[model samples]
Target: MSVAELKERHMAATETLNSLRERLKERRLQLLDTDVAGYARAQGKTAVALGPMDLVCCRILQGHTGKVYSLDWTPEKNRIVSASQDGRLIVWNALTSQKTHAIKLPCAWVMTCAFSPTGQSVACGGLDSICSIFNLSSPLDKDGNIPVSRTLTGHKGYVSACQYLPDDDSRLITASGDQTCVLWDISTGLRASVFGGEFQSGHTADVLSVSINGANSRVFVSGSCDGTARLWDMRVASRAVRTFHGHDGDVNSVRFFPDGNRFGSGSDDGTCRLFDIRTGHQLQVYPHPQDNSTPTVTSIAFSVSGRLLFAGYSNGDCFVWDTLLAEVVLNLGSLQNSHEGRVSCLGLSADGSALCTGSYDTSLKIWAFGGHRTVI
Candidate 1:
């Protein structure tokens, strides 16, 4: 065929495929009931008013020499474990801002970290493609280092995110750049179940984040570079329970709502979306107003009641959104003592009294309800 004819034929084929995909999506959505957002509006639902004094930076934990990439709070809510580019994982007493344990990592490129439910151990992973566990109860070596108690290895690409199963230190879940999520038997250091592979219905690109349902440990959601978030059940490793599509860019983070029946996802599209698990429909979309620059969302967390969504952006803006109203109720980045660099990660304390955010400025700040008007 002539060059012009060949190019025309290729363009036509691409258009046909795109059209087909959209039709399928529409058909699937049609089967869902009324969206949650519409129902809320019809019922005249509104979010509680929050003022600047409602939440304030209470403490700043500063010890890392390099950018802080990730952090997690202990279930007891008094301690925090942070991983930094400095190649160190420091466990801090959030109240006193004291470092109780500072251990050097074998791999410096760590991207994610989590505190076990009991707070007795911490898990972290990164470019090493392995999740390393450190037991705080273990004695330090003669070199003054807390050794890795166990390492879960199998991912063919970088380990992007990791989280311990709720109340079960013996099990963990990890998302990887290899476009898969794996459940690991922590004790045996073997794969308990692998979700998504050549024979499975999974993400086509890198799986960047995973959040397990607090209410039901069997269910979890994952965000990926393919611009989709998928719901998976640990019991069924061969296929995803559902695949959610809406974002125009990579889904950077996925968080389970406090109720566990819904989830929130932040994407490179500069938007955060709420999806209902039961109905398989997107309930709401929180979009940042377009300006000269739209920063990517790096991480997100939800308040205990699921009323507030805390999203961290690449421009160092930590926006607190009213989940019900889909409005920016407060900008933690504009507050006094905010981070000087990008907000890389954030999490709420188990009690819902405070929030801890890690930044590229090499510091983590704790924010708590400040005034009499306590709005979590």
Candidate 2:
């Protein structure tokens, strides 16, 4: 190596370090001069100032060998549960990037998983048509498998999604390919009520997603391949209160708005729609550009403030939409180190600080806002 070239490189490194040190000094000075709480209050008033495009790829959680189909962040925002086609359910400590539990499933085709509201347990189901619950606090069996505390088996088809009721782990809702959504009594492992499947009150195709109302727990909604979303009441499970229609393709995912007065649905048609539960009106529609082909919308989640909508696409793209503007605010797929295969599912941490996306690439990526750093 030439001495001149080495000296040039050394000078460049030194210049970069000095630049960084200057920036740090400026930041420290700004912190010292600013009113911290007032600044924080101002920041909190604007929910999510930085869009997904502004977010750096903070963590790529790699472990699953096959496509990760589903993931859920516990309400505590400290843990995540993911179910993969590799026949495993992984419980992750979100802060530390450590696996707390890696359970071997009895079946390999697992589709969905959800953590209880209290974060005490996890439930998952798939092509086996069974909803299995695992007590996270229980000791593992000698084989290192977490023993299943109960298995609810009444679904006639693959269980597509499962979620515990808000503030109540004793009950859960499960959507199925059988065109029905069931409310289950988790304590007894019995069916509480079947929400659909009858000629007059159910989806004509598979029920793909369900979202229980956070405000009024008795009411919940389901999205279906029938291209419709139905609102149902737990007290009257035999019939739907309203049937929402607009999508031309299968409704793949559904999620309640933070207020619970309305819900959103993502469809294979590459559009996400919002519907009002009371008026039964189609409130808004978010569609991909007409200039290019669209990818199927695989999953959707709402930010805690309901100001943003996160939609995962089959082409490995995750779009963040401004709820008020109804336009794509950011495309995570265009970013470096983004998912390489179809994005199968996505979810937001309870605190709304982190967004998680799972993909056919057999990995998950956690994206956080400007100041938060997830433990590696």
TM-score of each: 0.94, 0.84
Give residue 43's error in model 1 in angstroms: 3.1
Tell me the tens digit of each residue's lDDT in model 2 across 1-376.
9999999999999999879956965664454443322354566643344554466678888889999999999998988999999999999888878888898988899999999999999999999999999999889899988899999999999999999999998999999999999999999999989988874778989999999998999999999998899999999987999888778899999999999999999999999988879877666788877447789999999988887899999988888887766767678998888999999999988888888999999998888875553321
On a 0 to 100 scale, what is the lDDT of residue 240 in model 1?
A: 97
Against the true structure, candidate 1 reaches a TM-score of: 0.94
Provide backbone clash counts, one per model.
0, 0
Q: Report the Cα lDDT for candidate 1.
A: 0.92
lDDT per residue for candidate 1 within 1-376, as digits (tens), equals: 8999999999999999899989988996787566655677789998667778888898999899999999999999999999999999999999999999998999999999998888899999999999999999999999999999999999999999999999998899999999999999989999999989774579999999999999999999999999999999999999999999999999999999999999999999899999989977888888886575799999999998999999999998999998887889999989899899999999999999999999999999999998685546
Residue pairs that clash (backbone atoms under 3 angstroms), model 1: none
Best lDDT goes to which candidate? 1
Please list the residue runs of candidate 1 whose C-alpha ends up more than 4 Å from where it truly belongs after superposition. 1-17, 27-39
